[model samples]
Target chain A: MTNISRRDLLKSSAVTAAGATAGLTGIASASNHGKHNHSKSKRVVIVGGGIGGATAAQYLKKMDSDIDVTLIEANKNYHTCFMSNEVIGGVRPMDSIEFNYDKLAEKGIKVVFGSVINIDPDKQRVITKDNKVFSYDRAIVSPGIDFKYDEIEGYSKEVSETSIPHAWKAGPQTAMLLKQLQEMKDGGTFVIVTPPNPFRCPPGPYERASLVAAYFKKHKPNSKVVILDPKEKFSKFGLFMDGWKRHYGYGTDKSIITWIGKEAGGTVSKVDVATKTVTAEAGEFKADVLNIIPPQKAGPIAFETDLVGDLDWCSVDHKTFESTIHKNIHVIGDASIASPMPKSGYSANSQAKVCAAAIASSLNGVPMPDPSWVNTCYSIIAPKDGVSVAMVYAYKDGKIIKVKGSGGLTGPYNAEDRKREELYAHSWFNNITADIFG
Target chain B: MKQTKLILIGSALLASSTFINLAHATVIDRATILANTCAGCHGPNGISNGPLTPSIAGLPKNYISESMYDFATGKRPSTVMQRIAKGYTDADIKALSDYFSKLPKKATEPKKTNNHHGHNH
Candidate 1:
């Protein structure tokens, strides 16, 4: 057996080149647009243009050339929330994380820029804010996530716009938060209030805290970061804590970072915008910079369409991601009740592929295949110091469960290993973006 | 009694034939769906033209299957392949191996130079 190292596999540029070429050429050769040879044509309408929606559109066309895909998105451009923390930390610019639908359009998908106001399941149609109606044989919805601002007293959409910025959706708020962090003085305290469980990106709050700490370490050495989290445990807790101890002097009296869990009354109940103070169960704390990540639910579109039932998330069959409540409609990504799969960009992309395959198989009059999924989340503790967790899942016993002995976390902290993980993180960003858009 | 035995044998044959026909009619193309997932990263038909991901088309079935099993079991380490390998069952690994092995081996030429700007959207 030939043995290959992770570093060697990453350095194989020939393989990378072949993969890239195959992605683009494969799409072009598979799709025969403007050819009316098929006896019947199928229409697929997709809502939201994030990773999940965009991937589903592309894969649907590639799977069946004759299917008409119309993707309706509210914005002309989509700013990814995946790497926005880097923008706050001053590593990547905001424009670098922005995407457009020109690639989807080039793939013969009808990219419509409009808001979907309602969905008629019986009629199999979706209505837009502009009063336009689109009928489809199958509909896929991937509206990302929406915040519940009322959960935090004195925090509302208006406050998020003016004073506090969640920066969760990666738009103007992202820019505002970056400005706030950059302007703080030395020895200043930056307080980050993490939301409750089942939010987008489980390790996101910690990663943001790490990046902010990294920023202070370089620009203002005296500054410190305080993370108020509601959850007792988080994804990759041990790995993150280890890195924090080695780099940020965590657990020391003069540590640059302090993390308080729920047992210590870490959950914040109210925010005072005027005083820049957050009231937690334990006590009140003031900060030079305050970031409140409010509680979350499925995006508004899902609620408006009545796709979400009593559970704030849309119920779906783990096998095909088809909605259990509504026929001819499927939900993927963060909006669906896809547990055991943290709502990360990679997870959404993988789910979209499975949903696309199931939809195509249904339209082609074939049985759906038993589906498997893969997800890996990479967190950058500091520049060139990274860590990750990965898992593989399968549909079993009417639910998606992690495959036994399939995935694992990165081993103990080593400078060389961390640096390699960082490299892999960068390459992943490049490869995945290309795979989805092009 | 003799006539009843003949009728029972005929009924059993008819039922078996019907089952076979149903199986033939509804057979799921597991290999095709599985291949589509691989195409997302490796490229169509396992021939990638990208710079970092390898092309796995037209390799020997044993070679591909053994490599995947190694990745799944952590005998061979990779940044991404290990995660992907863990998602599959042994049956799936073998099926993918056999499917790709039968295709004629051909090298895919790179489509573009190193342009890391925004995707060609």
Candidate 2:
């Protein structure tokens, strides 16, 4: 059938029946539908309920409550990856970082707790694992990163689950890693293997090392935290180094943290799980608690469908974040290739707003508004020491460009300033969570 | 392709005249777009739940723009805002101020609920 004829058929049936209309709006609402209120509402289906999807869902309703928004998520409870490091550090409890969709449901968005198996762009339908299908005029995919376990020899998803916990995702793995940390004997070594570039939360591994060192300082003063990094430098590198020097006594024999960069042979070659040892160019290092954060790619759903044809991540137009490969499907968050924008929760939240605005504007048959984006990643190094990197982005030429003379790292170290940044970090947590899940 | 063409035309229109100067740009939606990016830390509509940040909602346009200018120019000693304010143009600041100045004065009190669930251990 021709595209126009199929839409006409859906519209004719939609006008006759009011009950079976919400799911049929994507097909029926293209042309005028004879003054029927149900047919006038455009349906937008959003997959994945993390920062990006949830924010898009909330903001879409906020912009036009008349548009139908449905959010499909695999897990009922969401533990934000942004602050999961704090949970692992034993500073904040796991429950504080965890949230449910009750608030979003209270708002007008339809919240479905199930895994989506397929998104048929041709048919404009998202099918869940349970065989239920949802149709939409536009679809937003915010599937966060998935690990490339095979990139690291002797490492797999099963290995990450049972033994060396990545704790990258915030749920059970976080708890598991925390348990391992607590159980390790005093003076034992805790090793962390970090991933290469283009991973979710670029500054995360360093922040993880810092907080873990802090935890050791209080609990096991003699214990050491070793970081094997694949990159020469990391996000907020100077600030992290400064914090390490002040708090952890870094660069001394008594230092609690040791970072081995790729230039110093920090790249991992294999992991001997039986011996709890990691082999790198530096040599095999045995550990009491090992963490292997493998290289990453777009979430499996992006690969399962045709969203990412030849690339590891989806290519999107910065203006609207619509997938260049597939029409009407917008990919945001870590799954999309939005360079100059780090894969932080703040970036996802920022991108979500732009995507929501674009989708809303398109559905209303109006010219899409120009977009502006902002992202600030705050890392708490110690209990009261924090640092950050921030940027404001604009759509220029054909890309999102960081505004010149704006955005920078935490300036030259002052104890009072670092403490204040810590407070701001906490405040940011409260505000962003409220913005997304509140 | 159709959407891309429209966006190009929109850019062309924006490039040709007073529209390039965002401070005087009359399209009201531009202000909202600039302001929405602030919702991450400032709370939605600039109504902050504060102990660290202030509620900028419903403030006078002059006060808001002046504060941003101060932050941008280092006249205001700030933790993060100093760096953030530098990113915006004078026109962007004007648009943000104009946007925030119109919001309601209502602010939700910072919630102090102890929502700690059980430890998995």
**CAPRI-style docking class of model 2 based on DockQ:** incorrect
TM-score of chain B of each: 0.64, 0.63
The segments of candidate 1 whose C-alpha lies over 4 angstroms from its true place after superposition are: A1-41, B1-28, B35-63, B78-84, B98-121
- Per-residue lDDT of B62 in model 2: 98
Candidates, DockQ: 0.10, 0.20
In angstroms, the error of model 2 at A233 is 1.0
lDDT of 1 by residue, B29-112 (tens): 677556555654555556654554555678799988988877767687555566667777778888889878876555545434
* Residue pairs with backbone overlap in model 2: none
True contacts kept of 2: 0.39
Over A220-327, each residue of candidate 2 has an lDDT whose tens digit, in order, gives: 999999999888998988889988999999999999999999999999989888888989999999999999999999999999877888988999999999999999
Which candidate leads the pack in DockQ? 2
> Model 1 over residues A86-143: C-alpha lDDT tens digits?
9999999889888888988987999999999999999778899988888777899999
Model 2 Cα shift for residue A76 (angstroms):
0.4
What's the true lDDT of residue A297 in model 1? Answer: 93
